[model samples]
Target: MTTRSCLLPPSIIRPGGRPLLSTGRAAARAALIALSGLLWVGALATPPPSSLRGADAACVNCHRRSGLGSIEGHIAIPPIAGPYLFVPRGERLAELGIPFVDTARINHDPYTDESLARAIRGGIGANGKTLNYLMPRYQIDDATMAELIGYLKGLRVSPSPGVSTSVLHFATIITPDADPVKRRGMLAVMNQYFVDKNNAVARTKAPTLYSSHTTMFRVERRWQLHVWELTGAPATWEAQLRKHLAAEPVFAVISGLGGSHWGPVQRFCEEQSLPCLFPNVEAPTGHDSDFYSVYFSRGVLLEAQLIARELADAAEPANRVVQVFRAGDVGVQAARDLQAARAHSGQQIVNRVLPAHATSKDLGAALRDVDAADALVLWLRPGDLSALEKVSPPTSRVWISGEMGGLEQAPLPASWRAAARMAYPVDLPGRRVVRVDYALSWFRIRKIPLLAQQVQADTYLACGLVSETLNHMVDAFVREYLIERVEMALDHRALTGYYPRLTLAPGQRFASKGGYIVRFSDPQGPRIAALGDWITP
Candidate 1:
């Protein structure tokens, strides 16, 4: 039941109504199929062409996981889902409840099972014309062709959950342990953004015709945001999110807030196939293998790598590394990450874990034995940093977590400021003014108080990005499609608040990849200077 390429010349089409596929010809055909980005039916045992990577994902890459197909430059990859393929000519897709997709071809004749098989076996279409060059011909067996057609027929055509004719519902998750001030700021931005989005749309719920596409009509759907606040321990957070989603079904989760433990929420999103976009978390937990949970950056985990890179490329080699952080905080993970990064460097790495409710005395005890030869790393909060005034830095080679300690505004006392270099994950303050000002202007107009500048700006950026992606999507409200569109749309963003640049591709979840290592310029205030250029560790 293995699939074979139907890219043979006319002389070699069939000797006796069967494909004459030799080893070299089969390999050559695989290359052509790979290049054409065609769907292969029942090729589970077939070895992919050596030069092409992700051969099995060819169809998904072109037609998309939603089967809604994408438009690349001038090329239109038409939707292949059952409704678009099998619907009789002149029947409005809206009448059949199929959401309008820009790439759908409504004028084409309907595809019968036999005609569809013919299209697959040759480069012909249901209308007796040749298909697009992007579509590769496949010589699939009758049984496998039937299975593939069945699979296409089962592809979801209706609008995703939380989508109505005139309103689209979205949710934002807030963990109980999240910072109250930051949560308030993020919510203010999200609420205001949603309000502005809906207000800009016409009051009437009339459906307007899509551009140049007569069969499909676009309805202006108002955006609605639901705030899902999770309570209790991290273990219970997932269940709470599930309950919230059940009560208020949403197409996607956007611009949420989390504290040290976003793992539960991240897992819940992945398991449910929900798009959790750019959540603000001190420490984001997940692997590149994950699909649904995307973040602006890796958070403190990225800072650890930045610090590690510094340590590796330092002019003076350190005899030992001393890391300090409070227990049960995101710094715990950051410390571990740095330790892992320095594993093969043959340096002595010591971790000083303070009590959850530690005091100045506890901080003093942690830095008790550090000396000039040692490289000290602090993964502490503002309170812990302020207390450092009492305990002078034990080493000149000191690295601090700008994220946990409050970026350029970290309250490292004057004595420690001169000695410590901060791992600033976001764009340098001086460089990002114009980009950040856009969000700040929106806040000022809406009269939303600027409590947490970075958090609010990031939330606004997330909302803008989602809105832009949706605009490109037109009326297709598929969750997978939303995520895919976000990945594609991120690179085109000119206003990436707090970040120098943001980009994402398939399997690349983190949008902003690198940061600058900075040192405080003055003893007090938020003034800072970059020690060097941005480093992507």
Candidate 2:
């Protein structure tokens, strides 16, 4: 029921006639602890006595709710969990029933209650060295400080259920609506990646030590992949995912496959705080606040932006833009995005949505109204593109989705190629030949059928990314750390297949940023030409 002013330190008066601390330094240290421990106080001029979650909020922002800490640029925020802080410099954490993390310093001496308090108040480590400048000094009373340290001692991060001394388990999800070819391709890449990983680890005689320390050594753990194939309707996918996750606990979801709706899968990952990285889905969850899911791009949404940019800058743009898509498909979102983008541009946007299982006969109805003064935007799959033979396209301007229509191989008829420009969200085919063909060669060697080229290539890239991140992680198997490491390492990768260059950061879920608007160079063939330089719109 009591509150304290944020400007002032922890109350000087103690309840029940008890001394908060024996010395003035200890009292100041407690106030310092309270100041550093609770971040919410800074936002309010007056904070309640219970603000730091009172005994429950030892590690706040930056360290995160997981207490696993985070990295920014060159600064490594050390883990404050019980095992990381209390263990001796020469001791192995795993042996002490503690999980290992690369962020935890093994060379640092162990901390006692008194030394820990001194370090908290004075900004000095147990080794008598000053801590990083990013770490702030705080002020709190003695009793509260003792309670905070006790809370930290109680915070422990033992290995998750999927992690073990000899193996690390990961799951790849496949929705019932996912394309069969892409599913097969993703699983093939994941299986091959695991086999290659174990073989490489086997070559090393022993787990390599990170530094010249007896306590620190990278334990060789074989990668284990669990396939979660979800059946039934989209509404039930999240429940099915929960059941599968409970039945087979995986450290994270990697390189999955999905179709028109990946919302259930996205929800499952967000709710569980499970890392779902780079699943091959055209329409991914658009919520930017969700941290657990990352994608290669905004899928069709990025294409919408690309098309909108082209439309917005035209010397004499179309007076009316007509967009056509399936009723319940990912294209629906893409069409809506384009409409919103060009809303105030004095262009009348029209949406012609066909049924989910629309036949070729239905194409005529959607294209009937499009004419010379209107831009025809097609948010459709290869089947729908092929169905366009039933009707002629408008003479104004035509934009087709390269991703949904199968990239350069989009089955648009020869008649349409001269007029239609594809929203190509990857590097040009000629430039990406070496990058893509390298994966194709590997597929041949492994005897994995290359049915879905883009899906397979992206899956291969995702597997390689996970492997590289784990190598950088050393022996740390923390789930949150894995996601953080992937974010940091993605930008440095030089061999990103399919995509021009993949990149991600703290809040960025999509890796590839932009693409080109291209048209068929020759009417009869698969070769395409870009209209201009890359645009990130």
lDDT of 1: 0.81
Q: In model 1, which regions exceed 4 Å deviation?
A: 1-57, 127-139, 202-211, 214-216
User: Tens digits of per-residue lDDT for model 1 on 1-537?
Assistant: 333446533212221111223334443333333322333433432232322233543555578666688778899888887889998898987777777787788787899999988876676898899877666555556755665676566557667788887889999999988999999999999999988988887665554544544324555689999999988899998889889888999889998998889999988987777889999987899776566789999989999999999999989889899999999999999999999999999999999999999999999999999999999999999999999999888889999999999998888899988899999999998789999999999999999999998899999999999989988877778887898789889988999999999998767999899999999999898999998899999
Best prediction by TM-score: 1
Please give the distance, in angstroms, between residue 487's alpha carbon in candidate 2 and its true position after superposition. 1.3
For model 1, how big is the CA root-mean-square deviation?
A: 7.7
Cα lDDT tens digits, model 2, 79-158, are: 87656888888877767756555567868789988778777666678899987655544454466558657556644465
Q: What local distance difference test score does each model get?
A: 0.81, 0.76
Name the TM-score of candidate 1. Answer: 0.87
